[model samples]
Target: MRYLSLSLVVVVLVATIGLGWVFDFVYQQYSDPKQSPSEDKIEYAEILTKKMAVALSSSNNANAFITAWQANDGYSLQIDSINSLALPAPLLSDLRLGKSLNIESDSDLNIHYAIPNSSDVLILQIPYTIEDNKKFINRYWVTSLFYLLLIVLFLLWAKPLISRLINLRETAKAFGKGELSQRITVGKVSYISDLESEFNHMAQRIEDLVSDVKLLSTAVSHDLRTPLARIRMGLDTLSEEEEPAQRRVYEKRINAHIDDMVELVETLLAYARLDQSMLAIEKTSIDLFALTEKIIKNKQKERPAEHDKSILLEADASLAHCFAVGDNTYLKMLVNNLLLNAIQHSKTTVLVKICCRPNSLVLVVEDDGDGIPEDIKVDLFKPFVRSKANKNKGHGVGLAICKRIVQWHQGSITVEKSEQLKGAKFIVNLPSVEN
Candidate 1:
């Protein structure tokens, strides 16, 4: 912290000094006494020059005016032949035309005018030596000192800020070194308070995701063992059975085991893919209402074969074109998962509704079956979470995949009691494209 503060202070001091020099140079250029003196000083000089010219024009008072001009107000008077003055031709022309002149030197000023109807030139001199500007130079030194002191104070005040940033960096390093619990505790008083808070949030998410992955690994191992053991038993039984009917029974049991394993593996793979950092996805404009209707129609055709019962799958699209921004494949997965869940649980009817709002599209899938239990509804989207009410004994990863897909598309989903169908309702909201 000390090194950083010193470095920053030195850089600031150098910059401040350079800027001060530049500003002084510009001021001197623009306010040069020879080119553009202050209005009051110019006016006073002009008045004095005119008074001297009038005095020199009168022969009777010329000698007295010369003596008065030399002794009063540090002015010197000189009268000489025009040729001896050695002035510029342009200046001589101006003087001959009755124009007065004021010329500035390093530390003095000379005012000149030609005496009317004479060959002589009258000159008045005012003293302003180098010593006269000492006060201004000293004031400049004081200003530079003042800025240097201010810069030092600012650096000292930032000491706590540097310490806080160092603490944040060390905490992040600890986190990177496998200490997942490390977190920053700085509050609103610090400079990077918002950044620290966001870091805490990100750390918490990472911890939770790690815990979930561990849980998913354990669950998969436990769940897969049962099916594999069953399949092994079926193989042994089929090898022993001689009757055709019994052999067929074993074959069917083994096939069921294989099917269950395949389903579980697919679900686990889908969940794992979502956790990956680089899941390539392309978003485009989709007619959400049309997509929902098409999915419902396809599900209706397969409903009887899967459920062994006739279920009415109805789609009510509120708009002709409910356009949204999303990847087509993820949207299909989101809708298919929700619709399949509803279809499997519905008693007689499943309803799908699509609507368009100001900046988003809303999709709702509801089933007229028993609603979800309050206890499990909160964690319905968590991996390996299944309610006791779901008799089908699903792996409980489908809704988790749906939740991830929704999040990937920058959308949201929630489960609630269906007010219209008196059952479990799933609502999905997606960003809509402008018409």
Candidate 2:
């Protein structure tokens, strides 16, 4: 904060100093009596000198000539010599240069006028009256006051911005020390508000990535232990069994455990990779209704006929022609995972519904089963999080992968208790084709 304030002060000071120099230079060149006559002064002096020379051509009285000149002018004049006046070197140089008029100043400015080849020079003493002094002081004082006001206004404008930057620096320090949740709040009128917003977004992404990595570590340790232990136990059983049939059974059990571990590892890898830069997403226009219908058909075929009677997969007619922007393959995977999740826990039926609004399409997958527990619903989208009811069914990366895919599509997915279906409702919103 202090550094910013000091920098602003320095800038204001430099600006004021530079402007002051410019104003002083202009005044000295055009308005100061000590300098050469301006254009107006030159014309006035030439006209006056011509009249005086003509008047003196027929008269020899210097006093009468000086009186006549003084009668029409505002200044006092006298005929003096070049050597007696102790004129400055510059005026003496001007006299030697054969110039028509010579000007010189000491404590006060004066003009020396002499006709060519005349030994006596006419001296006009320019006065410094109280009014002139007042005007000079007022001009400089007003200019200084104006510059001071500008500096004050600049400081006022910079104060809030500097304070915000200082706060942001402290927040960054805290974030570096592991306060991943630290974020800057943006004010509407802030000069760096856009920068602050981008920083907040970057910070949030970093926080989420760090959290996902930690959760993946913990989940791998906890979920893999059971399947690995079972695989070991199954191998031990096969080693002890002499009967071929029992050995075959133990071998199959071991293979199933191996498959579970493999599937878990693959799912975790996919969920982790979904956030990476290398993941290619080819977005095209995908009909939401047709996609939902296709997923329902595939899931129905995968379900056994006996279970079909209890768990019916139905796609609402509203899902028929609604279109959205998404990668078709990833969209299918998203729908499949969501529908499978619904079917696995549903009691009698699972419903896939797609509704189209003006700008967006909503995909809903819900079932008539026990609703999600209130405690776990909030974290359902997080990696390795699952409802207590279906904890043993699969690795918890399915919904997390769905969430990552949804985010990639520039959309959002949320879970809530389905009021109509009386089950866990998953609502996914995607940009409509017309959007």
Best by lDDT: 1
Model 2 lDDT per residue over 1-435, tens place = 344456667767766776677777866675657643344655675556545644554566967768776764467767666667676787776754544454545434465655445665556655555555666686778688768766776777679888988988998999999999999988866667767877887788788889899999999998899999998888888889999998988988899999889999998887777777325888888987767776666666777652653434344454455578988888988998898788777778787777776677888888887888777777888888876667447877778878878877879999888898798889999987752
lDDT of each: 0.78, 0.74
Please report, as a residue range, the 10-residue window in candidate 1 with the lowest summed lDDT. Answer: 307-316
lDDT of candidate 1?
0.78
TM-scores, all models, native as reference = 0.60, 0.73
Q: Candidate 2: deviation at residue 376, Å?
A: 2.1
Regions of model 2 farther than 4 Å from truth: 1-46, 49-107, 110-114, 117-123, 278-287, 301-330, 357-359, 408-410, 431-435
RMSD of 1: 10.0
Q: Write the per-residue lDDT of candidate 1 for residues 1-435, one digit (tens) a residue.
A: 344456567757765786667666766665445533344666787677777676667767687767766777676888877778778899889988978888889877787878887887887787774444664575587677767766776677577677888999999999999999999996645666767877987886687688679869887888899999999999999999999999998999999999999998887786777756326888899887667778877876865565443434344354555578988877988898898888778787787877788788888888888988887887888888887767875898778878877877778999999998899999998998765
Predicted structure 1, TM vs. truth: 0.60
Model 1 lDDT at residue 148: 75
Instruction: Please give the distance, in angstroms, between residue 343's alpha carbon in candidate 1 and its true position after superposition.
Output: 0.9
Report the number of clashing residue pairs per model. Answer: 0, 1
